[model samples]
Target chain A: MPPKPQNLKNPIIWFFASLIVLWAAPLFLPTFYVYLITEILIVSLFAVSTNVLLGFTGLLSFGQVAFFGSSAYAVSLLIKGTSLPFAASFFISVGMSALAALIIGLFCMRLRGFYFAILTLAFSQIFFVVVYKWTSLTGGDDGIVGIPKKPFLFFNINGPDAYYHFVLLVVMVSLALLYLIIRSPLGEVLQAIRDNSERTEFLGLQVRNYRLASFVIAGTFGGVAGALFAPFQGIVTPELLHWSHSAEPLMISLLGGMYFFFGPIAGAVIFVFIKEWITGFTEYWMFWYGLLLMLLIMYLPGGIMGFVSEHLKRGKDDSR
Target chain B: MEFSYFIYQLIIGLSYSMLLFLIASGLTIIFGLLNIPNFAHGALYMLGAYFTYFFLHSLPGVSFGIALVLAVVSVGLIGAFLEYVPLRKIYERSHALQLLMTFSFILILDDATKYFAGTDFLSIAIPKLMDGSITLPGDREMPVYSIFIIACGLVVAYLLWLGLYKTRLGKLVQAGTANKEMLSALGINVPRLFTLVFILGSVLAGLGGGLAGPLKAVSVGMGETVIITIFAIVIVGGVGSLKGAFIASILVGELNTFGVVFFPSFAMAFTYILVIVVLLTKPEGLFRTK
Candidate 1:
């Protein structure tokens, strides 16, 4: 008798169970901790979105944070400059990033592997420079501060817990959709391309189009996270566009497990918590981080999720 | 713009182009031969600059030339150690591991540099003989140091030409670049050739750093700044071609210098725009064989 994998048995039931647990987490946590969880949710979404290109499509984009930060800037400016609603600005920013992604992707997807990665970084750096130097418009290094936000109609969702719930809802929906995306035929096609791009091409699929689609999807999702970040944090900065910020998602995805559907989210949670814990003690967190990253790359190729998957596989093998 | 001033800026651009060529060529060779995208090349360059600065500053009467040579040699050795350490172990791994390890090296080297050199910017002293400016045909005075840099670049270029076209080792490296397994089958020690090529590549990068030390302010962020620009050069030049790297560097240097005169705010963006245009038209690079 073999045990059934819970994930495949009843995904809907599992989703609701997980959501209910997450929804009530704030109830047990202290009031000050709401901000922390909200941040985790945003970054986790960012990580998962990055995995779209990296894990599924096999394209390593180092400039993902360009979309994230640009979306943040766009949303922040839209809120301040126009009378648009939050939803409008959010979607608009995401749309802008996707459009930008298309433009950049058209040029970048011309190359494969290492060349593709560097080209993306180069493009992102260009954007970063623009945002940094355009002080008159983007506030340069000072960045735009005091960004205003409007709560949902008559809900008065001003409190931290209410905002947390709002963020949680957005994250849940985004993750659910992304999960569906990963489970669909489209997802299968992407994995096929990642596994053997030549064979996928030989199978009558346009590899470049799929890769470009992935770039746009990942960029749109990353933009959504950034859009959420600006209003959630009440600020937008040029640092968001920096190459280092782009590297964060890569680190998170790698750390959590690139193979697992939920790996990057787990990685992002671990990353934020580690950041919070380490920064509490020392300013040289980067040094420690480098050391940890070295060890992780050297020893833990599967990340935390990889480790879990290996154990699960071992259990299955033992049972059989 | 006045022709005289344009030529003056052009000379500055040329000198900087030479330095850029030195860095990009090394990276080109390493990428061609070893198949490892050595992200730490910039860090190695930065280390050379810091080394030269320290030696020159600490030993006041010591000549800048001696300091430069020592810096290049020492950093070359350090780069060899870097290759022997984590890089050798992960050569068989995925591109992800190679990239992560190199990135970790960047962080580690950056922090280590901060620990040793502190957070302050350091500059090299121009040698007394080359401290003066020389009068040009257009009645503009050009820095002798700039001319020296250009001369050094020409010398290195000529030497590289001789090495590649006239020497046994260069042929070995070139052959290895084409097919490592075939080169090994011909009874050559391919691993040693790889190590030697890596060392040579680092030495070239170090030389660029030494030359650049006196020109630019040495700082913590200099490595990353230079690396990105060099990446542009390497890409535009064609990944594995020295000729391409040389031409692209000059193009980039000129664009950066003169582009500022036209649009001061968008000077840097011009290089990236040029890069995008190149990627669109010639994805393999300007000098790619295929």
Candidate 2:
């Protein structure tokens, strides 16, 4: 008999299996669900980026959408005006976002807690207003529409299956890289800083450098998600840069449980599905959504993943 | 170039500052005492504006003074209800959860306003008695209503200061904030005090919104429109300090007035820049402890 298959309980094996499923999902699902899956993937990447600062570094940023929106516009502009391929445009978009994050992070990382959140929010709002007023380049309020998603180098990546596979590959690779970082010596130091910054400083670790590094990493991933999203949606709008939009991934991170590594992915799935389902029913979906969030906070402050973890631990205790 | 225009802008800015102070003082109080950042403070303001709009429009022969009083009291009741039900439980939860709940209230309140008031902008007509213009020494004429707003703000501030310093309830609240465990140990009903504070804060916010209705465009998203600026003011003023809120509101309002005149291009960005610079220099705020 063949050796027993790898245990599904292991997170690494589970993650790879989930990636395979994500890759194969479009072949069996309806077109609408496929679109939903794509949204989930994009938002998951965004949420993961948010979690890097929020969960890992204990920094709550309220302007993560700045990078996301900026990258979207950058990619859209490049694709619209230049002869660069999709891959090159994406690279350029992420690079531009990283540069922006570096500059903003210099000013922002100095402050912590509410001040940091507010500063980031102010920066994003400034970006939003500028984009809204800069009609010449950004198309202002009407936004840049009809962005073309070219076929990937030598692969017909226009169809849902192809795009889904491409996104799956990209997301898996990114996650793998993130996991490596988490398991690295730098990741250990970052965790230490999160638990006790004063102690970490006394230990001679550069707390600010670690924070800025995590911020840049988060920003680069946010830009990558934004670059993917522009082509997927075929539009890049000022709304993407709005503070309200920035709140989405933050909300997702909270709802999914920031403590877990894959918490944002779970959150992305729940958020997109809940939004899609609720909006289908009534225009007052926001009211109910808000009520649900209130309820969740009151009763389940640990979020969905945290709730699951508690139950799993209880189950193990009972079996023992 | 015009002297009267400068004075007019100054008064208008001060009036705007009064409204901001009324709302932001309550916000700062709630944040300081409860250690909960109430994002729904804006919703209470919106409710106040909506209530004033309906009261003034629907009721014939009712004075603006009476309508304003009714609007403040009613919005205060709604705020009390929110605190008693949803916010009361999450008092001990993480800041993230508190933020989420408040944020959810924003969505709920926005949609509720949309459902009731429709999506269009609603304007309140100023009372005929106060609608007339006052001629300034520099030959610049400004609305008499603005002067009334400034007077109202002063009256409210005086009352709040008196209540906080002189009243028995004020002593309890001060004691509670300083040492909640001790207050509870001494048999003070801490929860009741919190409820009272929440109501007072809510009413002030509502009053601010109601008074501002005539000046600003009152619409579905109007609460969110002013909230960011208010947050900036609160941060700059020092969170939880009433005096700080007052001073910060004036500072931000003056910045807005002058920012528009001197730097039209950067008018909107000025408040945020001020906040950033102040925060960098003094991260806790200009007046409060970290």
* Per-residue accuracy of model 2 over A3-40 as CA lDDT, tens digit each: 11122257688777888787778778998898889889
TM-score of 2: 0.93
lDDT of 2 at A113: 73
In candidate 2, chain A reaches a TM of 0.94
- Every model's DockQ, to 2 decimals? 0.51, 0.65
lDDT by residue (B142-201, candidate 1, tens digit) is: 999999998988888788878876899989877877778899799998777778888888
TM-score of each: 0.94, 0.93
lDDT score of model 1?
0.84
Candidate 2 wrongly placed segments (more than 4 Å) = A1-12, B58-61, B137-139, B175-182
The top-ranked prediction according to DockQ is 2
Clash list (residue pairs), candidate 2: none
In model 1, the Cα lDDT at residue B165 comes to 67
* Candidate 1 docking class: medium
